[model samples]
Target: MAARVPGPRPDEERSPLAVVLDVLGADEQRRTRIAWLYYVEGLTQAEIAELLGISRVKVVRDLQICRQTGLVQIQINGRLAPCVALERVLVQRYGLTQAVVVPSPHDPAHLPATLGVAVGAWLSEKIGPGQTLGIGWGRTLHWSVRALRRREIPDLTVVSLLGGIGRGSEINMYETASRVAETLGAQCYYLAAPAYASSASLRDMLLEQAGLREVLERARRADIAVVSVGSLGPESTNRRIGLLDEEELPGLEAAGAVGDLLCTFLDAAGHPVDHPLNRRAVGLPVEDLRRVPTSVLASGGPEKVPIVKAALIGGYVNTLITDERTAEALAAG
Candidate 1:
């Protein structure tokens, strides 16, 4: 029996072969060969046309007809690819907008600098003109600032999120904040007092100071806050650098604190572990940090993972930049 012909626009009952044979709008055989060679064989349209002694325009039309006649098929090798897939998983699992994982620093000392440069490059993309960026001071943040390239955005506002230096050795908070401000060519609103005072009453009184209050208010109004996570380990930079004191540790422990941001501790579940820092520490609260669109960049290896995990769970950051080893640890969790 002769095979039944099909219409250009096939209805429900048409066989695929009948559909293929339907003269959609071109030379079906030549078009099919062109499509097969161009798409399936990965030949360029020009190459296909040249090989077939046809014009590139003809090659394009032939391929289009091949598609119309159901003779063309294309497939993507992979979606997101491996690297992007991991990033997407982290974002979805942790409810984050973006996550960047840097390779483990060969030496502990260089980790900060390497990670910093990558993060700085990232921030270059994240920030734009007319945005207020709030920064917390620490060695990690300082390294990130160093990695940043200078770019002036006239409308950008840069401010310190916490009060300035106390007495410590890890990184100079004052220097850190100033460097970041200079790099961005943005105004720096320095928190004009110690991060911690002798007593809560003294802290309250200091908070009343005009300059300090102004900076704190600006911190609250910041569009994006960037901070580093602190671990409860004895040698933690927060403790070593005087960001937190020995006396404060007991209270934080009592409050289920595992790590902190701007002196606001977070528990194992990543929720705020409030304590005396609430009264004595000057800055936006951890909860407030969570409420704002913020990014947390922390690097240290397995030792800091638990604290980093807590930070993630607590909503202290919607974006996390860490080393590859730490990222695997997070994924393992």
Candidate 2:
């Protein structure tokens, strides 16, 4: 099937450069190849038109778009072809609106930091005024907060999607929301309750609280949600922050749980698994996330590749930012 493209309409307001570049920078492989061919391979529009079996007019338009959008830029080392190619593959494969893949470091331990900085840069480009951003917590997200460039957004609100993870680490739910809110010079709504209540009944009672209820409501209604996926390995943030017993891992694994988002466990297929802990969990449901306008998931590391793929298939994330290593792994699978 032919791929969709991203750009503004002819009548819409855009700089001449942006319009030209949009043509050249379109996600469709043919258009990209056309830009590459015309600029890099030194092919004329007519030659390219004959080569791709497309109309000469299309080649002209594509070239014009490339120029308008600044797709043609002089660089010291040239473009990062691998990351760009992988991003295109991911967008096509997962039906993502956008994909940002950063250079992967040799060590797996640093993937989150690398992915976080890239995600931060990507977010700065997409974020606008008056956006209510619902945020999830994890190591990668923590670094994202650090890397994010502070900006003022009028009436912007940042809501914590999960309940508090007090004093655990910099990546705690409280820390993530507060940091983003502070950076954006926006208001914040925190889920004051703990990540897991003492019991299902207690969870229900906590949910009934006016403060917690209000925040969760805002979270569900958020314009965008930024979250991370968690695998059920020894390095699992859910397992560590939940203070779960080692024995419980087997039960969750037995239940076919591969990973979790907002403390909602999921099977390999990304369906919410019927685990007993789910009843006591506090946060926005995955179904609720689907309702949000955009769900941005930033995660990487070899351990998370499978869960990330599951998240993609489950329709949990419309946009993804991760490291090239994980991106390549996802593409291969």
Candidate 3:
């Protein structure tokens, strides 16, 4: 009979470190193991050293070597870079004035705040005295205001294309308009009315008021209009801000609405939806928005792709700011 076989010794059991050492060998193994142990296992350098029975200095050296040897490779997976490329593509395709693409956080919702910074920076540079600037508000616009770096340019006039004065968050159009005005050392022109009135006649009547008409007229005369592309669905700005109720949404859809830019919904091809809502809108018309030397900043995630695409196609925006995913989608389209 054969002699009873003995189980392998504890030392014979394979370790990830030992496997790595076997592959990389003595000269590089120590540093490779240090990097794997620290980064993969979430261990401190001291802890790694203690575990490896090596000096802390040695552990540090190994990590340095790992970095130098390309073992610490990093890849950014998001939209910002792609957005920049998209900016180029868009300019070539549509002859835009300027485009900015902000990167999205791994989570899409985080894109708004990140884009806010980019939009703020761009606006800070371009906004100044004697410029009639029009603003259309949304969540991304609110973030842009928060991200603005204040400047001392005087005589800036901020005109709101739509009214926002309901029981919503304090960070509504009024606050955003005020903040942008304060940041750029400009005067604020508030449209003190509802975002959407009950009917076209009511909207026309409201616009007839001298104070409201003046701002609306100035908005038409704007050199720059910062507008956000709005998507469909219940959580959309038009729905949330009470601009559109459920009863009216079907009509907008029936009119071939995909999304909206400044209260005008458009189809996949970027043509206006042409519903009664279009007639009632008090904001800048698509034709007017297109003709102006405006800077349009749009950011969000995949949800905003359709609206943003429509805006680009409609010629309402000369500049587009977006994230990586949206950029990829634009490129893909």
lDDT of all predictions: 0.73, 0.83, 0.76
Task: Please list the residue runs of candidate 3 whose C-alpha ends up more than 4 Å from where it truly belongs after superposition.
Answer: 1-83
Q: Estimate each model's TM-score.
A: 0.70, 0.75, 0.72
- Which residues of candidate 2, in runs, are more than 4 Å off? 1-79, 166-168
> C-alpha displacement of 10 in model 2, angstroms?
66
User: Mind sharing the TM-score for model 2?
Assistant: 0.75
| lDDT per residue (tens digit) for residues 207-326 in model 3 | 889988888788888988898878787668667766677798888778888888877789988998778877777666777777677768566677788888887887778888777667
Shift of residue 29 alpha carbon in model 2, Å = 49
Worst 10-residue lDDT window, candidate 2: 68-77
In model 3, pairs of residues that clash are: 79-324
For lDDT, candidate 1 versus 2, the one ahead is 2
Per-model tally of clashing residue pairs: 1, 10, 1
lDDT of 1 by residue, 93-189 (tens): 8889888766666787666666666666677777778888888766567767755657797788888877767554446656777777888888788
Quick one: best TM-score, which candidate? 2
Model 1 misplaced regions, further than 4 Å:
1-83, 167-170, 247-251
